[model samples]
Target: MRDFNRYRHKGAFCLMKYAAEDGSEVEWIWNSRDGVTPFCVSNRTGDKMLQHVDWHLDRRIFDYQPMPCERIFVDLSPDRARQRAERTIEHYWNRDDCAHIRQLFGTKEKAIEGLLAESRVGEAPDLVEFGSLEPGAYRR
Candidate 1:
């Protein structure tokens, strides 16, 4: 169970505060002085402070329960979920032209582009293979 609240300051700014499951106090405060950026803070040291863009991308921030509940579950937006999946999936590129040459990219398109760029002028695309390595999965 967790508690959440929104506090307003003289009709100028708003801040959202919540108690984490781990008993830490978390707050998302906007910098009214700058009139732009918003950042997150937690009483617990070493906690990652999320920036405005990060907060917007996270669906959990907007799904807080006003009343105490057993648990709260929030699903990531389709675009955000896909971005997360891409992060964990490592794109790999290798060409038959060089047995010892292999490279890793963050996206499939980049992997293929890398392989094509490294190929000789007349080299066939069939000599190259682009694939993704699952998280924690390895190959020789």
Candidate 2:
């Protein structure tokens, strides 16, 4: 067999469909998130397996780990992912579709900060209203 012990693959945009605290299914499209690390060697057996590992491209290698989610899967392309992210943000702002999620980000400023931190050049801006970012404005 060809050496697949230390292989890496390009990442892509994907939707993370998960259950809320109320057991409601929510689909959130993640844009520009870290890609999956497939085909890893087992530390104990040295056996190669397609164990999925999540990468934190923006952080150090030590930050990488297996995804905690048990049901995340791909949903669409990058363009669609951007559109879905926009819609998700709109729901959060207008109807508080996932209010509990804010607790994970702390203050509103911190939430905005988190959004800005992940933004890439020429990419879609966050749907959350911020400085000069009018409500419902999804594009930069």
Candidate 3:
């Protein structure tokens, strides 16, 4: 019943872990990349979950192979979940909170300031010729 919760990458990466017990074995589960990943990393946290994830490990012990972690059954409908995820992305994108998104956001004051700066430089030409030595000197 232990828990550690926090935001990472400025609320971009949200991961959750769970502990489960099956018969005589224990397991740990974790989701990476904001819980968007299909599979969860499972190892007894102190046992071999970390090692199982490690590609270089070759140690052997138990006779029968045991599954370290099981994927929790997602109750949310896939289509609805996808739509929600999309909406979340769009929300962040529009708010300018997501830097990964190409578009930028600015406050009203900031937008005005930016416009003023651009105006200081004069209106930008709509089109320019390639390899032209100077701007506006050559037209399409």
Clashes of each: 0, 0, 1
All candidates' lDDT scores?
0.30, 0.35, 0.30
What RMSD, rounded to one decimal, does every model reach? 19.8, 16.0, 22.1
Instruction: Tell me how far the alpha carbon of residue 77 in candidate 1 is from the true structure, in angstroms, after superposition.
Output: 1.9
Candidate 3: where are CA atoms >4 Å away?
A: 1-17, 20-78, 97-140
The TM-score between candidate 2 and the true structure equals: 0.23
The residue-by-residue lDDT of candidate 3 on 80-139, one tens digit each, is 344444555556544545564434334434433433443312112111112322332211
TM-score, each model? 0.19, 0.23, 0.20
The candidate with the higher TM-score, 2 or 3, is 2
Where does model 2 exceed 4 Å of error?
1-5, 9-34, 37-76, 96-140
Candidate 2 per-residue C-alpha lDDT over 15-119 given as tens digits, one digit per residue, 9 for 90 to 100? 222223343333232322234422322222233322323333322222122233322222233444445545555557434656665777655555555554554
Best-to-worst ranking by lDDT: 2, 1, 3
Q: What's the CA error at residue 58 for candidate 1, in Å?
A: 19
What value does the lDDT take at residue 45 in candidate 2? 29
How well is each residue in 1-140 modelled by candidate 1, as lDDT tens digits? 32324423221222333334454344443221102222333333546443233332332233222232211112223333344444433331334553333334645666445544543322111100112222222111
